[model samples]
Target: KANNTLKEIAEILMASRSVLLFTHINMDGDTLGSSVALCIALRKLGKQAHILIEDDVAAFLRFLDKGYCTYDNHIIENPDICLCIDCGDVDRFRERKEKFFEGKQKGCIDHHVTTEPFADFNFIDPTASATGEIIYELLKELPVEVDKDIASAIFAAITTDTGNFQYSNTTKRTHLIAAELWDYGVDYNEISVELYQNNRLEKLLLQTKILEQITVFAGGEAAICGVTQEMLEETEGRMEETEGMVETLRDISGIELAIFVKEVSREKCKVSMRSKKYINVAEISQKLNGGGHARAAGCTVMKSYEDTKQEMMRLAEEYLKG
Candidate 1:
């Protein structure tokens, strides 16, 4: 996989004149930060680079480049190449997929285990903690210089995804890469607080409301919560604020699995799932047209809240049984 990805990266970089980069919808720090890091790397190489994110970035990450969160497709017309960061599959690109692939060259760099290697050049390592780790490796391979800004971008990506080197996915390589980044002047404390701390007033209020309804099942073996559209609208919190709140439910005492469902629109619900052991939530995510890792995964369910919640519960029950 490394050899194939390296050859593809070299070919794609050599062939393209301008490059367009993108990541998944409702992107996290890993997705947003990695995309920007790659864009900066390309620009440093004297290539025309742009990042096309799918939706509004989380408030916490607005500090990077206040204007870097969104892009227009008119600007994406007939590019020389398109690179995807932290996105696993084509479908995750949504409407942008057509315009993205319309470029002369296409590539994807991701860290999801379930990804099917769908790109002209693909570098996907499930063993890696985050796509940021892959970008760091790419920097080493291409001899790109890492400045403070680039280091912060890559550092935010890795630390956020690995839960500050605390999650089970945290590996020796993750720590070593982080050590190298620290050498580039990344402030671990500030970035951690910025990424995981500093919740907005409305976001904290939203979490408090959700916590009221959080429920545990089977003697604290499973945890679940639901957030309705009305609730979000009332709290002045967008879908982005729901990112880490799901884990609060997952981390309950003795809980092996956790599920958080939020109304995306009238007919769609975003489902975030996390597990401690012996559960593959990514498999569950794939069933609903989304994916992540064994411990953390997400999917959008298309149905009424009642029906969607029922379906998600059924799947979680089956996973527990298995």
Candidate 2:
């Protein structure tokens, strides 16, 4: 029944005169690839379609051609549909939410459990590993065939989100989809190198600096670390370099939780929390206005790192104690 609903969504889109797709801020590969795949698919269906590119440059995804996706307001010359994918809520739309939805038809496809599904037509599957996975399923529902480009894009989306099939979210279904993409001639090794191994040397230096700041709390039961713009500048690394460093702290023999507080700017801090066992970082992240999977989640903090770190630890400690 759920898959039927997503098929209805594809059918509705196929009939639309025009459509625009958007994803969360600081677009990652999964969001970018999924948005692009949907845009390409919609266009192939003989509809005017385009992907809205975020103004913020996601360092990890900088290798993608900037011009591949269009971000012009002129595409909305005629009132049509707007599609939001991977993103959970309107807030994740950043500055363009108002313009994207204002006086325009709305549709959504997402895989976030916390998503409120704010679209005229919505298809959300929280169990899916990534939005790209849902997109692949939707394409299967469509009578149209999946081409090489569409296959590659969806493959990129799922691979990145599942950490190249390393994360716990990677299920047998994910592997099956991966096998199909491989049959479609997707180069898994090249994509992995470009997406994950292309980090700059500065990011490595920053990782060293960050590792030096690792703090083990309550006898290694909890760990915390932070990075500032100044620290990033000193290491000549962009904020993206801090990607999986926090999880490294979780590697400690007895640490159950690892927290990384990154100062995105003067007042905004990007807080990423991860746990291995019983600690529910999701609950702690929600208290700070963030959301993600049970083991991994994040929120943005508008306060100083000191205050934010303290409050997060305080809230997290409660879970640890319980």
Error of 2 at 204 (Å): 0.8
TM-scores of all predicted structures: 0.94, 0.92
lDDT of 2 at 234: 96
lDDT of 1 by residue, 1-322 (tens): 3325665575567556788888888778898888788778777887778888767777888766534445687675788888878986777788798887787777788889888777777888889899999888887666468887888999999988987788889999999999999899999888878877788888888888888987677556888888888888889876677777777887776888899998877898888899987678899888888889999998888887767888888887776777
Q: Of the candidates shown, which would achieve the greatest TM-score relative to the real structure?
A: 1
Question: What does candidate 1 score in Cα RMSD to the true structure?
Answer: 1.9
Q: How far is 87's C-alpha from truth in model 1 (Å)?
A: 1.2
Task: List per-prediction Cα lDDT, in the order shown.
Answer: 0.81, 0.78
